[model samples]
Target: MASPTQDGVLEALRPIVDPDFGKSIVDLGFVKNLEIDGGRVRFDIELTTPACPVKEEFQRAARDRVSALPGVDEVQVTMTAQTRGRETPQGGEDLLPGVRNVIAVASGKGGVGKSTVAVNLALALRGTGATVGLMDADVYGPSLPLLTGVSGRPETRDKRILPHEGLGLKLMSMGFFLTDDSPVIWRGPMVHGLVRQFMSDVDWGELDYLIVDLPPGTGDAALTLTQQAPLSGAVIVTTANDLSLIDARKGLAMFEKVSVPVLGIVENMSYFVPPDLPDRKYYIFGQGGGARVAAEIGVDFLGEIPIDPRVVEGGDRGRPITLHAPDSPPAAALREIAGAVARKLVVLAERTPAIADANISWVTN
Candidate 1:
């Protein structure tokens, strides 16, 4: 085994790139120091700015990289703030109360299974032993109640909107407020205010994950989530259809402009299956459009879910596909997506979040 030296350590640090600057800390002057003594490694990680929330992350990455070197025995990492300017405004250190990791599931166009992904992802996250909440921010089309199978209006306690429940998930949706006969037709600010109230006035109660289902398009609703509060991240839903990918790009660009990280993209309806004949996938739309978009944007291609009638049937039945067919191909895809998202949140917590779990105060005892 080669001896642990500063040069070898520096070589190992080359790939740990900063998300804000897109450069290696070793080359970008963020790595403050490197000390190696008989396989014991101690390093100081200095961020480009003092407002860096990812300090812990850079430290962890450095430890992992250096610890993998030929003769490293123990690793000690320290983080110090040193920067050229303000850190990237990807949300901030202080997060919303009673909401730990808030992820918005969005799409460019409707009928692309955005809410389905939101419902199943939240459920799957719960499957990982994390308490989760689902909020339907789609005022024009609040389908969470339909998907999660919770109905009736949310009651109020001291003017706080009570959230509903769905198979190990706490939930809120516009459907719980308005009747099927009524319609919501306000502009951007109004839509934004309604969502803000959902965040502020609802009794979300201690959640490790709060999955928000937003209406399709890069419209007022999407703008509200990006502008009103700090979001953990966003997942863009797409399909193998080129048009959907194009729309997904618009939504992705919105997050980039707001400095929020794109967690990844989900390819829904990637294939098709029949009840009688199961071994065939009819590429009814196109092929690999979501994967291509993820590659182009340099983000993770979480995975794909086949277009099964069961998916829609499950929704109509108020049961997510993940709940019924826990091992089916589509459910497996959603679970993989939920897992990918769960891991990314851990990284995001190091970068911009200080609290491990938010929305604890609102949890029902």
Candidate 2:
């Protein structure tokens, strides 16, 4: 028996609609490189985002559809994702030419461990064998220097700045430029310039994910990032407290106003466990507040991070908990949250192609 034609394979996959584009995969240009050799069939599905949510569903649908054809002995499916606008920033220049996805980690207020989550999330992504970068956009209170244990100013070659490297991830932050513990007294415009410079000036090479540590609140730096850079989406970090949730909603609303999708909410410092009495759980900050807020706002509850003293020590020592204590409960939780956030980003990336469309204007310079 002879194998089916490539056209027949595509015809079978016509019913599979890409969840993000609201059109058939065939129409969306997702189905590609269809090849059939005797009883073997193979093809690739090119997705809009690496964090695509319906990846599994699409694979199953495509495999089953192709295998159902006559004389089909085995069906092989491969998926590859890429972003269209990452090379172009708002200034009509290619900033991060090799980067694929940009994720902003923001919070409604400070003191909620936002930087900690960002640092560890970057490390976890690196653990998954993907190239990653961590940028501390918290100009006023840049703590990535402390969290990642990287100090000193970045070097420049040929006028392009190189990011400080640590924990197997490239990094850029205003923290490296400041001295002592003094505050940055810049005006709104200055802050905006710093954000733009961070995105444009840094030489962040091809990255699977660039996790941005945004300044807390829905204020200047946050506004600058959403407008100046090409972000895949934002992740809201909040504690398990009523007031935190109240402020988190504002942060979520800010992203919505700019048309940047909120990937999900992460409840930080959700609980604690006593080392001596290892069996007991302590609700230190409160409970269910983050999940409730996510439900109220119609977003995903990514997961929770427990209040662990070691998390603080790790930060102080310049090693993220995810890398310092990979076996601890908090480390396990952080890794899980990182994976969830990554997956959601892929899904949101496909759904919100307009975000890339809005800010991305390719310039042939």
Best TM-score goes to which candidate?
2
> How close is every model to the real structure, measured as TM-score?
0.69, 0.77
Deviating ranges (above 4 Å) for candidate 1: 1-95, 242-245, 274-280, 351-365
Error of 2 at 263 (Å): 2.3
Model 1 residue 209 CA deviation (Å) reads 0.4
Question: Which clashing pairs does model 1 show?
Answer: 48-83, 54-351, 98-359, 99-359, 100-358, 205-362, 205-363, 206-359, 206-360, 206-363
**Candidate 2 similarity to native, TM-score:** 0.77
lDDT of 2 by residue, 1-365 (tens): 87799888999999999765578998888888888889999999987655455778999999999999999999999987654333334445555567777889998888888999999989887876668999999877899888888889889988888999888999998989987887779788898778777877888978888999988888777777776667777888888863455676788788776667788889888888888876677887677778888998888898888888889888999988987788877898888887777766655555555555554542221
lDDT by residue for model 1 (148-250), tens: 7788988899998878876998888888877666777868778867877888888887777788888788877777666655567889888777445557678
